[model samples]
Target: MMMMQKPLLLLAALTLCCCITSLHAYRKRGCHCIQTTHNQVPRKCIRKIEVIPVSGQCRQTEILITRRNGHRVCVDPEEKWVLELLTKLYSENETSSRTNVSTNASSKLDA
Candidate 1:
């Protein structure tokens, strides 16, 4: 029984590692992308980024994004629309976190 459990545990760990590795593949930095030409169809992918943590600051660090059709693309990280979208996401997160903290504090005080 104990031997069976050991293998099961190892398998679970391996599965988790594989999942994490695959997730990182989808969030790859500096993906080798071809230069776009006028003839190709445009991808409908939305930009996503892995915000890097450095010196206690969170910063947009890459051009990884996905399409509605599950396709991934590496875009120009410094594009104006990309920056605007990142800023919008960050602000939304900040406000939601503040609201959560305030709600938790009020509940604790009422208890």
Candidate 2:
């Protein structure tokens, strides 16, 4: 009975250690946003933004924006400046598109 108890305790200890190790391994990794630019100025510097994780690991999320022109933008909730910049960019893009459409329609009407 004593030998059996010793084996059971050893197994329990090993199991506990394995569980702890797995938990540590599963922990999230931190990440920061960086800017890329086609020209001299780095996009990050112009944007003045860095992304931090709001929940979980930053790498685990797909928090980046890709422009049609092949520009990459990072997204993170912790970076309010970046968020605002993105919002402005979106608004401007939408406005420009709308204006172009309106201009085309007007030209068609004139024709």
Candidate 3:
């Protein structure tokens, strides 16, 4: 029975290691990693770039950010500036869409 118990313990250890390795790989694959060095601060140094949906891939879809002058910038997604930009852009898009819908409805009523 002692030999059987040792094999079971060894199996459990191997299973734990496999689980840990798999989790690490999953997180690495799904995570949006910032490849920039730790010292870069584009948010503080450069201005915020306006996100235009119709601009036709002004940036690749991978959390790309830009400076105010329409130049590419890299920043952490968690940064305050990135959050503010996201909020501002979302609000503008929402408002503009609402305006378009209202105008369309009003025009149909007029006709």
Candidate 4:
């Protein structure tokens, strides 16, 4: 009985250590992305622009051009429209820290 109890306690302790280490590693490997609106223009139509944060404070801007021909295109232009869209998107989709962490972990596994 004593021998069995020692091994069980050791196993429990090892499991706890592994859980903590994995949690830390996961946090370190994940990133936080935020989208924000950079600009919008009314040139016969509304062109919404936004930026998506790829990692940390780094972002990629995208422009959504709404043409008079009733067609909308998403483009990564060097214009201010991309910034506008990013801002709007980020504000609307911003998740809590816990949710973000889970999403990051899942994304990492998928990648």
Residue 35 local lDDT, model 1: 38
**lDDT for each residue of candidate 1 in 1-111, tens digit (9 for 90 to 100):** 998999999999999999999987884343233432222223334433443222212233334455456665545545666566667666676666654323321111110
lDDT of 3 by residue, 59-99 (tens): 22234444456655444545665567567655675666654
- Per residue, candidate 4 scores C-alpha lDDT tens digits across 25-58 of 8645332223323344454464332222355433
CA-lDDT, candidates in order: 0.47, 0.47, 0.47, 0.46
Model 1 Cα RMSD, 1 decimal: 13.3
Segments of candidate 3 deviating more than 4 angstroms: 1-34, 37-62, 67-70, 99-111
TM-score of 3: 0.32
Weakest lDDT window of 10 consecutive positions for candidate 4: 102-111
Clashing pairs in 3: 47-68
Better of 1 and 3 by TM-score: 1
TM-score of each: 0.38, 0.34, 0.32, 0.32
* Whole-structure CA lDDT of model 3: 0.47
Pairs of residues at least 3 apart in sequence or in different chains that clash in candidate 2: none
Which model scores highest in TM-score? 1
